[model samples]
Target: MLLAALFLLSACKTEPANQGFCGIIPKRLEAAMSYGTSLYLGSMPDQEFLREDQGRSLRQIPPLEVREDPMAVQAVTRGRCAFSIFEESFASEQKELQGLKSAQLLYGYPDSVVFRMYVNPAALRGEEARTRTLDFLDTLWSDEFQSKLEFYGLKPVPEGLRTQVRNDLPGFLTTASESE
Candidate 1:
């Protein structure tokens, strides 16, 4: 039993380091999976440093717990890649990439599937905003969004936005802030 336990622990080692700030994602220093539903990354750079073949992960933070579901958190910056496609279209197509006007997307990985929803009490109000949010999420889960994720290498695409988790965004931000 002791030997079996040891083997199991060893077997749980994380994936080989391939995803980094300048690798799969342009902002690649390192992207990590956390105990909670969030993955944190850092070492942002300016646009001048951005190069080709680099991209960001789009994995949404998972839920920490049922109680953590309603807390809206801001977007976490993994790294600054001026070349990242997000930056390229950030202003021109912000609404197209984001599900909620109050919520934003990040570059993530395949193992950490992102199914996130955010509600901003200030910006998101009234029937119009609510309707937009629902429509955005629905469109996010559609084939188009999943394909977008696949291109960025964030896979195991979520079934839908019904799996919204609130604590993840906060958790990711905390990780990024503390590490800095």
Candidate 2:
């Protein structure tokens, strides 16, 4: 009876399959689940390092125009590229990439935020799963994705700012979560 009770308790303590950061789910996935939501809802600088780049000021630009301009599209594409590289650099340290997906929110930028959900090795099984995941990620990085980001207040991450945010994700998540 005691052994059976112990087994039940351990099973109850197991983490859910669908929890954790957008890119990687942890063993304690629930503790980190809020982090992913926070990343989507938190207020990131509209333009990172805008002031340093040729005196361009993201703050000065109207949000509507930012959403519509070709240059802005290019900038966002660059930012996404940089974000991908950054994600890869930290791949071993973080969880495996599940694929990029978006969640819709009325108040968030672009009306939706793109997320790269990570998959556990336990979850990876067949070729179909892998193919679908890759396709989703590709869509998320396409021009359509850039348009979505622009529709929200977010612009492409500047290289310098991207580095800063990558370095500071933990602290940023903490602060953002606390405020909520």
Candidate 3:
């Protein structure tokens, strides 16, 4: 009976699959699973970084808890999480707000987290709707909005990249307009 009970207890204990950050699942990180929801990284650059660069899939090593961006910074500061991904500017801002002494820079992904606006064709069923959506998209690319990006803690793509994007815009807009 004693041996059987010990075996059952050992089986219930969580174990790390491997060593280091990539191997750190909720159990390994010592984070409370009840604190937040599962990390929902749908198509984010952080997801790709874990997959390609770290050789780990979120499925195999899910975080115990995933908080909102600002809360994530606080979690790290408070030692609730082993580490969390953040935009450099946003992390700095949060660190200052939380009075953290410092935030160490982790690996930076080659691609940046981008902000994009997508309007569903189904949502634009009428001509007026289509026109309004197009105008909204155009306004997003306008110099006025571009200038305000930094104020909102966003950085605009470089001028060369912006020119390339502008060149591609006409065809994209035409396709969106033609969509039923």
Candidate 4:
């Protein structure tokens, strides 16, 4: 009985879904924390005036914490994304993003940031993934999408969705410039 119990305990581990990509854990965590804290902490500090927006957003969202487990990887319902309009943008073809399992902001330099939906190697069949990525990008960058988010008394798209998966989803505001 003692040996069995010990074995069970040893079998348990703690790490995140993308443990093999440990090198990225810090940067990803930093991005989520950096963006979330600023947005969450940016709420109006007035209680009386805020009462009018009760149904809209009476409370601020809590900051997100990164979870890492080694024993098992569960399907995550959320992702993180942080972008600034001040950054430069570039287009990323599918061939350039094969290792990416999700959509995200990739900063190659101070002014060279690409908003790309990367292939997960496992997200879907190769052709299906390519099609889905293009479709997702179109929907995300649509003017209607941004307007809807702003109409909801919410910040723009990236600031509106407060989920880790938000980072994995294509962002509407990060599209490449027409001149680029």
Identify the leading candidate in terms of lDDT: 3
Best by TM-score: 3
lDDT of 2 by residue, 1-180 (tens): 111101111111233111111132212222222222223223222334323321432111111111121222221122111112122222323332223212211122342332232222222223343333333333333333434443434434334533443443333222222446
lDDT scores in order: 0.25, 0.26, 0.32, 0.28
Give the runs in model 3 whose Cα sits over 4 Å from its true position.
1-111, 164-180
Better candidate by lDDT, 1 or 4: 4
Judged by TM-score relative to the true structure, which candidate is superior, 2 or 3?
A: 3
Query: How many clashes (backbone atoms < 3 Å, residues ≥3 apart in a chain or on different chains) does model 3 have?
Result: 0
Write down the worst ten-residue block by lDDT for model 4. 2-11
Model 1: CA > 4 A from native: 1-107, 110-115, 120-123, 156-180
Model 4 spans > 4 angstroms off: 1-121, 157-180
Native-structure RMSD, model 3: 19.8
Q: What lDDT tens digits, residue by residue, belong to model 4 across residues 6-90? A: 1111111232222111111222233433332333335323445335323322122221223333211221111111111111122
The per-residue C-alpha lDDT of model 4 at residue 90 equals 24
Ranking by TM-score: 3, 1, 2, 4
Segments in model 2 whose C-alpha atoms lie over 4 Å from true places: 1-122, 157-180
lDDT of 1 by residue, 67-173 (tens): 11111112211211001113222333334324322223333453432333333222222334333333333343344444445444454334443234222332222
